[model samples]
Target: MNGPFPAIAEASATGETADLFADIRATVGVRVVNLVWRHLATLDGALPWAWAAVKPLYLGGLPDQAAQRFRETMIVPKLASLAGDAPTSVDAVLASYDHSNTINLFALGALVAWLRDEADGGPPPPHGPRLRAPDVALPVLASEADVAPETWALVQRLNRLGDTAQPLILASMYRHLARAPAFLERVEAALAPVQADGFLDRAIAANRAAAHETAKRLAQAISAQRPPLADKIETSVSAFIDHAIAKMVTICRSIRVARGQPL
Candidate 1:
């Protein structure tokens, strides 16, 4: 995690934190740790407790199942077709984030539901095998100094799409994409109109609401007890779910979809 976000850098994590980070990578089957999880590591007692509660969900593939269902029902605004002309690396970057973020969105969404309300007595989540993470390697996240000034500014601009939150935190995807700024410029060109007409916001809102309920249902299978830091952890998870994860899930999918990629 970099920039203004309060997170222990993955390279800096040691001891229990480091081991838990490894478990998260192995269990999620993604090579990189996502920003939300890293951000959680900065909170005292948050990572161990939160990860313990959700580990079974990942093992059983509940979040993966939940994420697919979310995608099926989720509204993805079709952008006008000129995007996706970037390099294979750009496509790979989009593919990887599209997979990992959507999964975390649902997994953490389930955690949020379990924290806020009682799980329904409905049947357990259906058994579905989760896909292994995409093997494509993404470039390291670009710092402002690494990219041209205008490109870095565009990264900030794209990160602000569909978000009205104050003191915005950068989405990791945008930072990674900055490594390919031309692709990001294309992304901005594609999404700028979508955001203006409010199609993007509606889609983000619909998906967020749907995911909340789906995750609530998935939370039914979780038997993990509340940790002492549940309140604080819930607050952090809710923020990401409501803000970054909620918005990016749709944006990433839209980018992939417009690029003629199958999500």
Candidate 2:
């Protein structure tokens, strides 16, 4: 699960960090803690505070509700269908991220909005049952050793989509799918137009803005009291919510939409 950006390897986490990782997986109904959370843990004092801040949103089903609303409203663009007979494992990988990222986007988005005071109202009351993650196992995120040289390069290239600015954190989705080079090859073919025509960033920005606004509405669900959070923590959280997670959510879900699959 290593990336260009620094993060605590989930397996190597110990003591409180390990405990937080476990809590995240259980509460989010996902098998693994996401890269963002793991990255946050790399910073001093960031993980514990941030997790404490956001855990209530997860418990109250605020993120679950927000994610459900988001699914209905997402403007997924059309892409050419991927041609190939990939295994069921491919679907499982995408579904795992599709479910996990959507929830994290809102859950973390709400945290960002609340911290910035972009949303009105205080914490929300409990909103019944939390949404369940799909029953799927995401492939272990691939490293260069695990994939062909060309495929590893393609994975890195795909990670740079919409990188008019400096490259953001490497997306774990591309890495996860690297185990299926042919699948990623088709993905590159399908998305090349979107990237070349400058639609990729537009689509991602629109989705991010929409999620940001929706998350602000859900901001009342944040349970943390207002105090000055660390600048580094705020900056990192904002960047991920603004960039990597949003972009991947759009791309992964768009792929599903084009394939006539349920997202």
Candidate 3:
């Protein structure tokens, strides 16, 4: 709100001509406000797509079907996506970006006002959300070598979408990866003392042993594919191996608790 809203509102208040461009921007702005409100209702840590979604709303005029598409695709996904990452302490995702609620709320309000102006035969204004920092690059999924095979695959999917903002997506990736063996290895490797002490080394070896056992059992099940699996279980064993490795990383990470914590 304070970021872009007040300036836009002041411009609207002070402009001599109620032109079409301004009006269109105003319309798009209003849609943005509604989006922010809905974002609040679906509160969690910031979404990867939040900023990207805003861009279309502010820069491109809200199409007639925009809300419907949003309801079906985005609204439903939000329920499942935030299962592990919602911020219990915070009420808004915008706060994660260091913006005060005032600025966020206001920017959206001004955009709404502009939209109303457009509905009244004001000029068709500029539309679509503007990225605050256009120079910021999207985050890439780390390679399989860097991350567990499974986490790498999921992260790759998320990175490819490019629909979400980089930081938000990365945060989610990290949050979920936090539950994977791949993340733990990265953490342990980062802390030399932890490794030198053998605390991390022992833990990693033990976890790997368990994961291998599980993968072997899972592989057997897949190969044993009974009548139901007859020609239907056409997936390659290699593919299953990769998936199993990834799942193992995720499961291990999920059950992991930090050391040096009070019991």
Candidate 4:
């Protein structure tokens, strides 16, 4: 129920850990390292070990493949769509959010798959096509201090939208979207019905199951390539992935629901 392990601030990252942060952003094709990796970096040797274990798969395109498969396999209920008369700016903001979420979910899913194998003593997955990170710009994530007062208040409100009592669980998606206050408002409005009608819960459940199956398939493919790690490290990695995956599913589904996109 509590947030996953406290993430070391990017400002404090140094040496190999800092390098890994850069590599993760580059490899994952995103501007910011998701909170999941930042939290994992807090553990002794966990970040490097886990990154190394999954790097081959990432470089080999297994993550892209898994993400594609996930997109195809998962489904969710359609809700009342955003109005056709919505402004161009609103459409642009939603498009940006959609792109960012789509890129993140699959790559994060790959990391979860590799970590699951390490935790369960499963074999490594096979390599696929060698690929490079895409050349696209992601939105700048606004720090709490930098966000406008109104936007910051809305961020707080959106963070509290879910049923959970864990006040510390901040979704980076909102922080990133804060740059567009109107967009955030649209998101809040779109998600209200899903939350009220309990579709958000159902969407989260579907995402969780999809994440699990994605990880399972990845583990089977890369089972033989998993590197050795201490039992303690493995346990910690497993726990972190479990929490991260669930939170990830929640955020991913929430965004999809907001956009009236199929989960």
Model 1 scores a C-alpha lDDT of 0.85
lDDT of 2 by residue, 198-238 (tens): 78888888889889987886777666655454667767888
| TM-score-best of 3 and 4 | 4
TM-score against native, each model: 0.95, 0.92, 0.21, 0.72
Q: Once all C-alphas are superposed, what RMSD does model 3 give against the true structure?
A: 22.0
Off by over 4 Å in 4: 1-4, 77-134, 161-168, 221-263
- Cα-based lDDT for every prediction: 0.85, 0.82, 0.28, 0.59
Which residues of candidate 3, in runs, are more than 4 Å off? 1-172, 175-192, 223-256, 259-263
Candidates in descending lDDT order: 1, 2, 4, 3
Please give the distance, in angstroms, between residue 226's alpha carbon in candidate 4 and its true position after superposition: 8.9
Cα miss at 126, model 3 (Å)?
62
lDDT of 2: 0.82
Cα lDDT tens digits for candidate 3, 1-263: 13211112212322322232234335333212221232222222221123322333434423212222221321110011112332322112122221112122222322322222211232332333433311222222233566557666555443222122222212223323433544334433333443346543444344434333322222211111122321211121112222322222322222222221111
lDDT of model 1, residue 103: 90
Per-residue lDDT, model 4, residue 30, is: 56
Q: Which window of 10 residues has the lowest lDDT sum in candidate 2?
A: 120-129
